[model samples]
Target chain A: MATIRDLARRCGVSVATVSRVFNNPDAVTRETREAVLRAAALLGYTPSAPARTLATKRSRMVGLAWDTGHRGPGWRHPFLQELLVGLKTALSERGYHLLMLATGEDADGHLRAVRRHSLDGVVFIDDGTADPALTRLAESGVPCVSLDRPVTGRRATYVTSDNAGGAGAAVRHLYERGRRRIATIAGPGRTHPGAERLAGYRAALAALGLPLRDEYVVEGDFYLGGGHAAMRRLLALDECPDAVFAAGDEMAVGAVRAALEAGLDVPGDVAVAGFDDIEPASLVRPALTTVAQDRAGFGAAVAAALISMIDDPDAAAPPPTVLPVRLVVRETSGPPRAG
Target chain B: MATIRDLARRCGVSVATVSRVFNNPDAVTRETREAVLRAAALLGYTPSAPARTLATKRSRMVGLAWDTGHRGPGWRHPFLQELLVGLKTALSERGYHLLMLATGEDADGHLRAVRRHSLDGVVFIDDGTADPALTRLAESGVPCVSLDRPVTGRRATYVTSDNAGGAGAAVRHLYERGRRRIATIAGPGRTHPGAERLAGYRAALAALGLPLRDEYVVEGDFYLGGGHAAMRRLLALDECPDAVFAAGDEMAVGAVRAALEAGLDVPGDVAVAGFDDIEPASLVRPALTTVAQDRAGFGAAVAAALISMIDDPDAAAPPPTVLPVRLVVRETSGPPRAG
Candidate 1:
């Protein structure tokens, strides 16, 4: 209930003197500043966060800008729960609370929203969609770090799993299992992860001396329905592939269901592999074999890079941080049991 | 980039007049307010959120007070991801941003934190831990709605799944499967859900002309290890139970795993059921039969109640809203297939 006037009156000073003591202490005598501060403490006249931000140009709040609503309706990050756990744990230890900013109708609107909120910095969740607005924001001077997408800016960086490497490993893992006729349910090429993983799949087939048949690759939208349709297409090919790899686990789950619905035993007739070993991967029947990204580690790394950008405005934008991924050999793609 | 002085100069008004136009428009003349507003629009000198909060004591922010860190380490809400998606969708529609307030060391600190952040209201995630801080917060004048718990205050209400109804249904379903000697993995009695679910189990047995065997009721922490340990204890009894109902899905999964490891068939040797039909329930082998809560609906209801309270300060605290839940019959607790 106490105001600046109360503090000023209690300390026998003008309101401006009280303000200067809190905002620009050097403008007042040391004794006067101390007396005002002591009075402020006594009267519980603590400055508000907004006032402090206006004075210091910093709010201990990080803006979380996610593009899910615009990218694709109902498109959820596979391991988002774990990602949040990681982000909150790391951000809390560093004394910053995440203030999720709305992904407005346009690029400039997002910038305006951030300014209105007066966020210190932002962590953008690039939903692997080639968003022009996200691209423009990345080029802005506001300190930021993105997830699963790359951008070029004076103070911008991105972090993602080794998409290319994981895709190639999935292909190689299938090849090592003696399935030369391998097909893939690839994601859309517009996304960074999609493009990179597709290139990796192609490169892996070339290295293995297997002809990359055009019909073997089906483009998907990293969703279950897309994967099921893509798999149906792959299954209907003239020469059905003996093995399949999906760029994402959701599609892989869909693929497996499509195969089972067609009365084909998984790993017995057509081996299957997926990326992003989310929870459903292990829970599904014949558990899915997939590329496992360090979900929590990815979130933590994003927090670290963004904090670095926030703390040092003059620091150069760091290079894209690529987290490692490994193959989880579950029943869906593992070797058959001994007879 | 334009300051109040810049705006005043552009509008040919005093600096105090420019402030008055934005802060206390009623005090300014219509012509002068229009002139200041035009200048503000031209000069891009909009008042910030903090400034607006200071002037009008309202922030379009809802504090998300979760007691996870203070509760048991590594305890996660089974359907947190969905709950958040629900909350975000509803909050965004109403033009409110969720500000996750950190659960500090004690109760009063939470109040201080809310005040420091200038939050308009709070949503306390009472993690069924009998938290004193959460209780105190609900009792405060700050508009708040709790999840999975209840409290009494002038502007406080809570929303939760029908724990008792869900639990009673789980027990009755097990009985329908011809398993009368049912055991239970109840959560801590100090919490609401745990206590209600346990009470339901007791009532269901008595209603079915069965005794409430003390040894058949084991206390669990609504966790996997706790469920596994409780199941092992029941299995070791001289007259082992033919069915088990866990208060939580995580614990039910543990119970199922333990039963399988002990060479018992789920829903055959020992029919099992769980609550909170989360994602893993359907994916698990012999899929878990559990109580399904409307996860997103829970968040939406919480938001609706909290927003109502915030918008209507004089409104009495609404009674605790209990959302309906249903039993999901799966391979884990369903009747055997006809030969």
Candidate 2:
């Protein structure tokens, strides 16, 4: 209940002196500052966030806009959890808190939520959809950064894993194992990551002088069930592929489960590889051999990008930063079996 | 950049009339509202969030206070992910956003972060520590709701799973399966869930007329590593238990891994049961049998409690609501093998 006036009256100083002592103590004499601090401590006076925000025009908050699309419980992905931890740690170091803006079923909901919040900047998780709201936000000059997906047709800074490069490495790893009949469970093509991964798969096959079979590719929703169904479809093919590479760890786990259920040996009968080495990748039987992205580094990069933009809005837009990915070979992918 | 005066001048109305159109449209006539809206749209005027918050103390933001204590990456737990999904869904429906406040190593950091933000209310995830900060927040009447852990000596609303009951059911189920030597991997004893679960384990052993052995109980940090270490210790004991019950599913997974690594058949040698059936419960090999708590329901209950308190702080504290948990019989805890 104590205001600047109350502190000033109690300390026998002007209101401006009390405010200066709290806001900029170095500008006031040591005795005056001590007197004001003593009165404030006694009165249990704490500066209000709203008043400070109004004065500084800085909320010291960043918005994390996540759109799960129609797929529910998207937070179940361990990759997102890792990213969240990284972002939280990085932001906290700068005295900023993360405000989650869950852009539910509707894409426009994200824009509306972002507009309503007094966020210093925003980091968006691309749901593989083209959202005009992002363009609008970028145009509004709010410091914005997209994670895992680039904002198409917009100049916003983007932080993403080397999706295409990771996918290519996975394919190359499989190829070196003498698995010529390779297949892929590509993610939905509408999203940037999915499209890049699929492109990588095709490019790898073409570079290796291997024939690209249309039946070898199936689309998945980057989830366990979708991967399972896609693998089953591949198994039903007249000539099953010798190796399967999934674009995500969840799907890779599902594919492995499907292969096991069909009475097939994991690396012996058919090699399985996945991307994004999530927690389950190592826990599952045969321990997935896939491409591992630096999730924490990716998160930190995105946060740094957003914070920089927030600090200097007029600075030239930073080039889209793509963190590198590496291959993690485990029991899932092995040398080709003797015919 | 356009102010209310600019809009009023363009619309040929007083500044108060223009302000009324934005703050309370119902107070203005339809013609006046239409004229002001059309002029405002043409002038590119948008109400600032800080100004709105200053005018109305309600920030429409809820804080999620997560204290991980000294353990890093504690937020990566699947249970927390599921709860976050549910909370986001429920809060989004009510036009509220979730702010994540990661309370670092310091116990008092949570209180400082919560106090710094203009949150309408906060949902605290008790990390099993006796935090005086929570008590102070509750005393300050910030409409606090503690989830999964109760704030002792405080009248704050609490929503948690039936830890004791769930543990009892898991133990009794093991007993009915004809397993006598049962051990438990308990959580940290300083927390509520851990204490309650330990009590339940003891109560069940007493009711079943089985002697409670002190060496059979090992404390874990509610993580996979802890569970794995504790299980290894149990395996090294002079009389290894026939069945093991872990206070959390992650620990159970670790226990199962430890047993399998030790060449022990799951149900035949050492049955494993866990509490808090997370996504990994069914995904892991030998599908863990554990107590399944309604994670989404728990999230909804916590959100509802916090929102209610925010809406009506004067309302009598709702009695501590405990959601039920059920035993999910799976491959890990099958019937005892015939001698």
Candidate 3:
């Protein structure tokens, strides 16, 4: 518990010199800096983080704000775990610790948490476009980054996966398999991913010269139950689709389960494709054919964007970053069935 | 941003009186407190968290430390997510935020992180018993609660599930089905759950007058791959087990996959059981029959223990709380096949 004054006295230097050595070593002479460091080492004097934060107005901590109020279909999805792993790794490398701020019942819970804690920056995941809190946070001068959902009229940097492109790939892959009747379990059109993925499904069908059948398209909540119900509806159709594409892996797994319970062999009766190559996608019976978005890359990019904004608050807003996605064909979506 | 001095001047009180009103309101008169509060509200004066920590030596923040170095078999398991949801719920109710501290490459990473941040308490999950860092943290006088992994000699509050009892239940359920030769996929012995579950498996066999065959027991990492490999090894044996119990649900799912891939029917040929009762256990084909631990209860118990300790550090070490477990019968471990 040695103080700066004690170090200054032990090193035979003024208190200001000792303080300068710790805060701005370049401003102090090399010899004086070495003397102050040696004295600090000998005396077991460590700089207090709170004191430094008070002086520098920097906490070196980042807030990860997410809305946990809704228990949606994607609640148990594994993509979140992968994203966290990546975000934690990148943040740790930069000497930052993640403070998880769950947006509680109140609409402004996240904003309250951010204000209570002195965070250098914040990263919001799944923040819809119309949250007035985001605008207030941006106006409060906190560097911000939005993931999955883009924020308009705010200086917050946006990072997301190539949802539209990945969805299109899934559709084309299904079409190339010679499945004349293709169905889709589209996600809710409220969120960015849901809207983009649904659009991709429609665009791909049009591009492939296939008529978009309204009865073949079912809107789902990007969850297993939704997929199961949607698949049941598809089965009741006069001409059942030979292939089904789900906007998410969880939904696809649900669809697979529904088909099996109906005594139908997957890929033999109906091909299934999904987005987000989560771990469960591979563990499921007929390993899911999915659009593999690099969850780790997405997390790292978001963290990097927020860190850069924190470092240079006045820097021009960087263009939104969209990570690429690739198709992973597994047992669920095999070769096209014979005519 | 109004300071205490400004509030004191506006309220016609001394600076010490205003400070006392904020830090120890009980020491001030009701009239004085009301006047100080009114002045503070009018001046828009808010107490800074760091400055309050400097005075009261409490951060009102909790640190969650876990080992991420080993990408072990349980890396993608759903138990952590369930536990986190529970912990977050409990912590939020107590007006606390979770600070995720990832233990990096350095063995003392957690310790350094703890020391740098002003955490009122900490909750350590899955930290090995042999970590000297835990002892150091205990000696550092920070209130701590260990989850799943019990740490001895540290006076730390311990909370865990009834692993042995749960495993015994799974075994007895298999025995009731008249399975003669039962096998077990045990978790790594280093972890508390792994060792306790193995003990339960052995105790159950002894109680049932069944032989504990060494070949019937295989060590796994509580992951899907480990279970798959262990099952493969069992299939190669001259006397393959009629029923298999995996220490974790993921491992059980893997075992089921292996049996199916080898053209064997689940329950009809080789019944399979698992522990944890994760979401996948019910979703996987055949719906794995397993032991169910109350994940949310465990999390809440741990959070409550830490909060109590933080509130009164001098309170006698409460006995470690062990939540009960139950057997959830599903499709996988059905009645033994007719001989």
Candidate 4:
């Protein structure tokens, strides 16, 4: 292996000259730059990036911390995939690397990975409200941003869709469609997004002057299985609700299956709406009426927030930027039919 | 921000002695190590890991390269998810960091990232069979391992599950259950795993002395929508197969919906079995009877292969290890009555 100094000596130039040719060619004469380039190619000399980063005080590496177990593998929420694409595309523009740091279940391992990689920043996605990665990131003095969940009690920046507003819009849509007995399959309450969505559901019901019934709301884990169980419980009620709003798409699909099994027609016997409008939402029979979170936009916002923090560590972070959401009315939600 | 050399002079010891306290504490006397540690902590001195790694010629960072547009974000495949978990757990024990490198829309970005990061080894997961990442990894003299795909024309180490064998087991399960007219929703024919699975399906039909009808086989994109459309076409036939075997669980879920829509009962009227027994398999109403890949073992195998290559670059690689598969006969498949 040839050293940079060897190339410098071979090119008949000072080491500083070679560094100038590589880092900023405009600073060196054309002839000197050509000589340095020839020597570098001949000796297969690759500049030490980490060393340069150390000198420049910029590692050019970003941490991608995620909740690996939020939903089981194989049935990845397709909504997140779009967000990832947007995030990766933006990060590449600035020449930064993404390192996967899965949270929970061996957190020490994640912390160790972070310290070893020397990441310049971290972007956390799909984590619960009380994730420890936030505190660890804070202590490390690395610029960090959270997506989908606001980092609580911390000065960390965040980018998330308007979950509460989306849920409210969904409820309003159901009410406008003439649904009085509206029920919701709320996702796990521990997660900030989930809790906010549930709050929105309650607020909408209260505004509509409808008495909230315990039997109408069932705890759903945000997967198809949980939705199926919740839907079954809702249907077993003495007077079942005319409409259902599921927090996640998977749960909504489960609700579809439960409705079909009971010989009830979608939008006639019961209407269903979901959030995150995953790929399967449109493909399923009759399609799904749901709220569409701008997944790619959310990812872009988070990436932009992280880059801003990296650019100005001491800059006052604009209050966690919240993206907007809209209701996508499909075939599922409609006016209630006569009993 | 204090330098280690400054802390060493204050502690009245050589720089090497202070390094031993941090890097190899066991080599130093406990009292001396404690003194050095206390002084360093008080001075807020931190060791520069990149400088140490450059001197030692080991970054302790493993590269994970995946073809862009594959598993970049919408990772819905259960098998891949399980494999990720397995790989993460196995490599954490070896003190190696996994850096995700997407072989950009083109291959240049991937090469740049790999060259910049100075990765120790790389594992390519679920990429195309002729992906450029394989060629780059081989040329870079980096020990590389291909997961779930064979690296053709390259002597690089590879690990995969027995796809053909898994498929054969599924067919045999269906045959034993007395389903003669067996239809299959095969994946795209260009991929290795999908092709092998299709071949296995054919081989079983030949061995069972059953006539293989061309109409019974439809190419699906391995998604639920494709499955539903394919199932609809099969249902339109003058005579449909008594059982259907889908290459993936999502497709099988679609088949379940199609069957129900046609007023057919799963296993009672039309048996449905899927491969890659993902979490959703059991969650679906009747549950899926399919072939289960030892995903964790597969992940471990890839990690172990990559590590061994790193340890002995010149040593001959063991033959490609194929993890075993099992037939999980759930409620989806049962004996076929006169249809």
Candidate 5:
């Protein structure tokens, strides 16, 4: 209920001086600024975050730009809530909040809103959008961090899982289990994770001296249906693969469903592996053997990098960070039962 | 890149006059304001949201208060990501952003943050914390909407599923399947959904003229482990119920796992049902027969109500919303076969 006038009157200063204390604190004398703030505090005047932004030039709020709507209702970002929890927990400790930015079709419109908000920094969550604007955003010199995307800039960084390592580990695990004819259901080639994971799968096969068979490599859109279709094709090949690895868990589950529908025994007839150990991986029949990415860790790392970019402008932007990943061996991809 | 000074100089106005245009636009004459704004547009001056707040006293930001961390690592809010996606998509249409408000140990701390942000409105995600602060928040004259918790204030409304109706449907479904003795794995008594569901179960049993045996009702937290423990206790009883309904999907899955571990055939020896048609509901073995709450619908409804509150200062707060739910009869609780 208190107004600026009340604080100014109590401090015996002009209203402009009081405004300056919040709008342009540096414009007024330090003593004047302190007197006004101290009086405002006593009067229980709530200073809006924007008001604080006027003086400090920092909103203490981070912008989260995500274009997830394009994914449709069927697709969900794996572990999104967990990632948000992690990001919020870390940011809360430093007195910051997250602002979910709207990313409509117009990329420029998104940037315009970002500028209007005077956001301290922005974190872009990669949702497999090949939008050139996002790629250019990393080069825009704005303090930013990308999740699961590898673009970087003067003040932009990225946080992602070790896709290549995880994929390689999955392939090697299958090989160790005596799976000689290995195949893959990969994600779209456009996404960073997709491309890197595919590369890892190939590299692992190359290291093991397995011939690269084009028929074994199937491209999926990283959803259940795509995985299922790819698996159907794999099963139809003249020489079916002894094992299959999917780039994501959703697809892996689909692959399992497809195999089961085809009357094949999982891990016995054809072993299967997947990336991203989402909840269903363990709950699904056969208990998916997949790689587990640190979804929460990605959030914490993004927050840290963005904060670092904002707090110390003098320092270089945090380098692209790759959190570790490990394979979770479950029922679906164990070794052969007998000789 | 343009400053207020540049715009002021361009318009041949004093720097104070330009400041007034942003900080106190009403104080300036219409002609002077028009000239200043036109010049600002021409010069590409980016006014911070805080500056706009100073002029209009409206910050188009909403607060999201959730206390999920306390639930510990093992606990996860089922369908959170879907709920958030729905909320964000709807909010995006209105150019509103979500601000994650930190609700740490100190209840007052949450309120302080709320006040500091000058949020247009708030949407509180209920995470089973019965802090009086949340109850009081509804009555604090701040425009707010609660999810899954029923509390109303002058400017507060809540969005929740039809717990009672859903529970009754589940019970009746089990009964029609020839289950004479029915039991329930209930959620915490403190939560609104939990209490309402328990009441619904009792009402259904009473309506059926079946004796409400206290031994059949087992209380569990809204988590997987709780349901598992509750199921274990139920199995140990001298006379086990033929069918069990868990208040949540996670718990229902746990109950199924417990029944299987105890060598009981689901839908044969011991039927199971659950609420919340989360992703794992259909994926888990026996495909849980559960009550499907519209998680995304809850988000959309919450957004609509909160926005209505924020936009209309004089109208009455939207009344509490109880979204409809439907019974999904899957493999878990189908009718029994011939002897």
Candidate 6:
């Protein structure tokens, strides 16, 4: 409940001096800082930040926007949260701040708030370049960056993982495991990673001299429910595949459950693989074989890229950088059963 | 790549006028604002934020100290990430900026950098009160707020979930399912939530008139590996309990695998329950029975609380608010199997 004035008065210094001690301690002598500290301790004082921000114009805040993709804030999605930490870590160095922009809020309305609030820059995570919010942000002339998905022709900066390469590797792994009749559970077509992953699956199949089984591929909405439904479609096919490669761990997890329900033994009767080697992949029964994306590295790269862009939006040609991925062979996949 | 000068020249206005137009469109007449915008578009101009921050001392930034936790940046953790979005939403409204702070950065070394860079306030997510970085922020007089755990001594404001109450609800649900001799895998004791959950488990047992059995409790680090090891110990017991409660879904998932490995059917031979009802909880075989935390609501509440503190730090009273928790009975627990 103590105010700054009380501490300043107790320290026998002006309020500005006390503020300087807190804000720019190096500007003031150590002795003066010690005195202010003693006074603050005596009065149990915590400085008022909002009023200070009004005066200094440095709220030490940043903005974060993410698309949870229908299932609001699913606890299963750890990849997005990790990227956030990487972004936050990069900004915290210079005492920068972070703020969250809620989803489903009106687009133009949100931009008005960002402009009026004076955000330094906004970071869009997993959102396509074409999101209405990005359009408004660009129109408002706000410095913005994207993670995992580029905002198309917009001059905004972006960072993303190598979804194509990862998916390709996953299929390649299936081939190496002697899975010729391999199928895929593709993600929604609208999403960037989903499209890239689908392309990777196709490319891998073509390169491996295997006929592309269109009926084997089904689009999943990237949720357990969608994955379950998609798996059912794959099963309904007359020529059921020997292996299934899902675009995400969630879908792979569902596929595993679906396979079990049909009285099939995982890895023994049919092989299963997934991308995003999520936490539960290893924890789940049969221990899913997955492609691991280095989430921390990806997050750090995005943060660093965004910071660099903020420093020099026109420094050099900001090329779209893609991080690498690896296929983790676990208990989910094995050699095809002898005919 | 167009500079402010080019835009000003195109608008037939001074550079200062152009800057003012970007900062405060209201300050300029409607005609002048329109001219500036047209000129900026023609020149492909974007305002330099750093220069403006230096001049106005408003970086429009906020600092975030995110807990990447032991698991790293998986983005799979929806609860943490959703809270982040909520925080971003509130800060964006104030025309402020957001920055992701590296968890271990020190203020003394980066004092000038922090001041030179503008920050309005610093928000810590799931960071312990005793963190060295937070201590420095306090000493430097930075305004900070925490989520999920209070920084003791009121050094900063906090928003947290009711961990104890949530755990208690899960235990009570198990009792109602007619499961006695309930064993539990407790999370690491160092964390506040983990400790609270352990307390809740004990309290519920006491309330149900069941003697707390020491052998029935095992320590888990909230991961599958730990849960697997803990389950092994429980199974090794001469007379193991019929039901198990794992503090985290990940642990419970491991426990499920362990039980199946021992030839026990879930909820038939040995019932299993978990907390955090993560996506895998339902996706895994037998669809885990667990407790569900409203992650978005938790995030919204935390963001609301932090913003309130940012608005008025020295309010008459700071009430500690606890969000309610609920039990979600699934396939995990039921009446004990007949002998």
Report the C-alpha lDDT of model 6 over B67-184, residue by residue, as the tens digit: 5543443313436555665556565555444556555544332232345355645666652334655556544544556665556333355665677877788888887877787889
Highest-TM-score candidate:
3
Predicted structure 6, TM vs. truth: 0.76
TM-scores across all candidates?
0.84, 0.87, 0.92, 0.85, 0.88, 0.76
lDDT of each: 0.83, 0.82, 0.81, 0.76, 0.84, 0.71
Identify the leading candidate in terms of DockQ. Answer: 5
Q: What is the per-candidate TM-score for chain B?
A: 0.85, 0.82, 0.88, 0.83, 0.85, 0.78
Fraction of native contacts under 8 Å reproduced by each candidate: 0.56, 0.52, 0.44, 0.26, 0.81, 0.35
Q: Residue A204, candidate 6: how far off, in angstroms?
A: 1.6
Q: Locate the minimum summed-lDDT window of 10 residues in model 1 chain A.
A: A101-110
lDDT of 2 by residue, B1-339 (tens): 667789989989998898899879999999999999999879867666666666677777788876654345454444776777778888878767788887574655555555555577788875656567777776666777788667542337788888999999999999988899999999999878889999999999999999999999999988889999999999999999999999988899999999999999998899999998877788788899999988879778987887887777578557777999999999999876678
Candidate 5 residue-wise lDDT, B169-250, digit = tens? 9999999999979999998888888999999999999998889999999999977888999999999999998999899888
Instruction: Give candidate 1 regions above 4 Å deviation.
Output: A1-47, A103-109, A175-179, A225-242, A258-270, A314-316, A337-339, B1-46, B70-73, B103-109, B152-154, B176-181, B232-243, B258-270, B312-316, B337-339
Model 3 chain A TM-score equals 0.90
Over 4 Å off, model 6: A1-78, A91-122, A132-144, A152-157, A307-313, B1-63, B68-78, B90-99, B107-122, B127-129, B132-145, B154-157, B310-313
Q: Write the per-residue lDDT of candidate 4 for residues B1-339, one digit (tens) a residue.
A: 566789889999889999899878999998889999899868756666566666666666677775545533455445554566677667766756577665464555555555656677777765344666567655566677777566643336778678888888888888888888899999777766778789988988898898889999998877788888889988889998888989877888889889989999888888988888866676566778988888779878887887787777576655788889898999989766565
Candidate 3 CAPRI category: medium
* Candidate 5 stretches greater than 4 Å from native: A1-47, A314-316, B1-47, B314-316
Between candidates 4 and 5, which one is better according to TM-score? 5
Clashing pairs in 3: none
A139-161 in candidate 3: lDDT tens per residue?
A: 56677878777765345778888
Among these predicted structures, which one has the highest lDDT?
Answer: 5
lDDT by residue for model 4 over A1-339, one digit each (tens)? Answer: 566789888988898999999889999999999989988877767777667666765677787776555454433544554665677777776666677664454554445444545667887765455556566764566677877666643336787778888988998899998888999999888876788888889999999898888888888987888998999989989998889999988899899889889888888888999998876676566688989988778767877877887788676554798889889999889767676
* Best-to-worst lDDT order: 5, 1, 2, 3, 4, 6
TM-score-better candidate, 2 vs 6: 2
Q: Compared to the true structure, candidate 5 yields what TM-score?
A: 0.88
Model 6 RMSD vs true structure: 7.6
Selected candidate, larger DockQ, 2 vs 5: 5
